[model samples]
Target: MKLEKSIIGMVHVQALPGTPNNKHSIEEICEIAVQEAKTYEEAGLDAIMIENMHDVPYLKGAVGPEITASMAVVARAIREVVNLPLGIQILAGANKEALAVAKAANFQFIRAEGFVFGHVADEGYIDSCAGELLRYRKVIGAEDVKIFTDIKKKHSSHALTADVDIDETAKAAEFFLSDGLIVTGASTGKAVYLHELKSLKDKVQIPVLIGSGITAENLEEYWNYASGFIVGSHFKENGFWKNPISKDRLKVFMEKVKQLKK
Candidate 1:
């Protein structure tokens, strides 16, 4: 699937079984996830992505099979409900596990971190996963599942690779075969700089997505440059990713997107 110029809604699934903040049973998690996916499709999102974001203080690199198992259930449930393209992200850089889940669930793609340069994320050190992850995808027969990687990913210190600028990072990821690139501010809910975004657009051949802080109010600033927007916080009740997806907010946001398309 060629994913370009898509308004992809972030469907952050409730904490799945085995995480510290997990409150719902596996069934409950799947139910809530399916409903969120349904709402995003009904509101006109081009695609919806499921994330284990609520699994706070995430694991450093690998996740247990239970995490993968529950995600499979949720992903399948969401697939059953929504006809739009669906994707997955296993937090804290579990790119291989996420690919396995995406394949089992028949998901279209996955959002990944630590695909190129090393970073010290809040969870701990995340090593580059590109070589292993891509090989794993081939072994699993999931070459069609695209991997959209984060460059200088949010909420982390890049001092380790400070010498390597964003442009260098973009070339490296491309050399490593990333299907797309993501640009973000320092953290979630923070806006990506248009100048920096333009710089990246000038630097890379792959699709560039704004990974955070996109709202109806600021959509125009990025629409001309970004091929996609991975929106989460802006669709919630109070612009919080933790809050449930607000249909009214989504409707209003999509209305603005429609006008921009004109």
Candidate 2:
């Protein structure tokens, strides 16, 4: 599979639940999302993904209609502002909802949490959705929109399926027609294991992305092994998500990635 060398930045919109400072209205959230997308684009990142990461303690299946509709509006606004390849990810394993939003916003892809394997997560059981998700995508005529599946997902327990290794699970996703494979750390904002990244890259013919915990210091280490990265935390001021995206931090990170390319 062909892939881009540059890193893929994530704009984790401040749409989480129960935060006093969080935006209460959908209009407010979408406005912030648009600004964040433009910032990521200006930073020279290859692509941008908008996720409801702030919506912590996420629900198991489908979220409320308001959440989905709100997310669509935010995603659409971001798409309107940036020409970069846009992706949408609903919290937990809301694959169908995310796909719907992606289709509505004309997004290029989505980051699916539990696409091809069953596992126990903090919220509860996250059953594999590759079968249903692909069918839904077909029904909506969004076959061109890529499905980037996560293997050995973070912040969740895959111990129920521990008997199956990462390579086997990744192969299963590929068999199910996943457009790409994402290998993440054990939790959000954590770094991935280089060993696991190498193993997955060696096994798959499709694009493989590191989904978290990338920093300027480690970009060189993983750049050669994976096709791309999805970064968020390190780009923020003092490495905090709530802090604004730092222009200097982004400049430094991009410089490192460029040097590695040479």
Candidate 3:
């Protein structure tokens, strides 16, 4: 959970069973995830997070038991290989399910959605679940698994909280005891507004992480603002999320990060 200036690589696990995009077996998906994890570790990422992003047309709320089971199997397999901190995120506001997977897989954290405030996401309305999510974590004894929540999250409409600005959102999340705050652009792979990052610096005590659109070309611009960067698409082939991880691309980005750390 110590994410100061850390680079967390995303392992976008392929479509799982019962979803419309399920073409590969769980075993096939796990193999791809493990290989990507090895590449991320080899490329010197500080952490790895497995997400069921490819489970497209994502379920509106919590996914079925099959999705959870598949994720656990994939997460456990990845854990067996990589020594870096691991995490999981069940899509479309499945924070509770994510915590369960993290605890079972021995992951260090989870990227949670709708921690504070409501939003109209592509999947549907995701209600604020800070109280319920934290209670579940306590019930399951997964407090050690950090929950990094999204503020003004991508791929969603925040019309429900239009009066609530980014800084206010950050404060609310901090007040609700989010382990960290994730700031992102309007959509996936889009860069966050530099001014938004600047504005959030003095607003909250919790870690503020850049959750999208951080590339090696512009890493220096965001370097001093965020405690960590969660990267996915930029490390993939041709900078597309659906593409497989590109070792060379990841290495180049990490090399720059290493230089900055020095």
- Measured by lDDT, the strongest candidate is 3
Clashing pairs in 1: none
| RMSD values, in order shown | 0.9, 1.8, 0.7
> What TM-score would every model get versus the actual structure?
0.98, 0.95, 0.99
* 64-174: candidate 1 lDDT, tens digit per residue: 999988889899888887889889999889888899999998999998999998999999888998999999999999998999999999999999999998889989999
lDDT of 3 by residue, 1-262 (tens): 6877999999999999999889998889999999999998888889999999989899876999999999999999999999999988999889888999999999999999999999999988989999999999999999899999999999999888999999999999999999999999988899999999999999999999999999999999999999999999999999999998888888899889988999
lDDT of 2 by residue, 1-262 (tens): 1357747888877764343446567767777778878888987888899888788768896787867887888888898889988888898789899999999989989999788878888889999899999999999999879999998998888888889999999999999999999998987789999888888877888889899899999888888888878888999999877678898999999989878878
Candidate number that wins on TM-score, 1 or 2: 1
**lDDT ranking from best to worst?**
3, 1, 2
Candidate 3: where is the Cα deviation over 4 Å? Answer: none
- Cα-lDDT of candidate 3: 0.93
Q: Return the clash pairs for model 2, or none.
A: 16-54, 16-55
Instruction: Give candidate 1's error at residue 69 in angstroms.
Output: 0.5
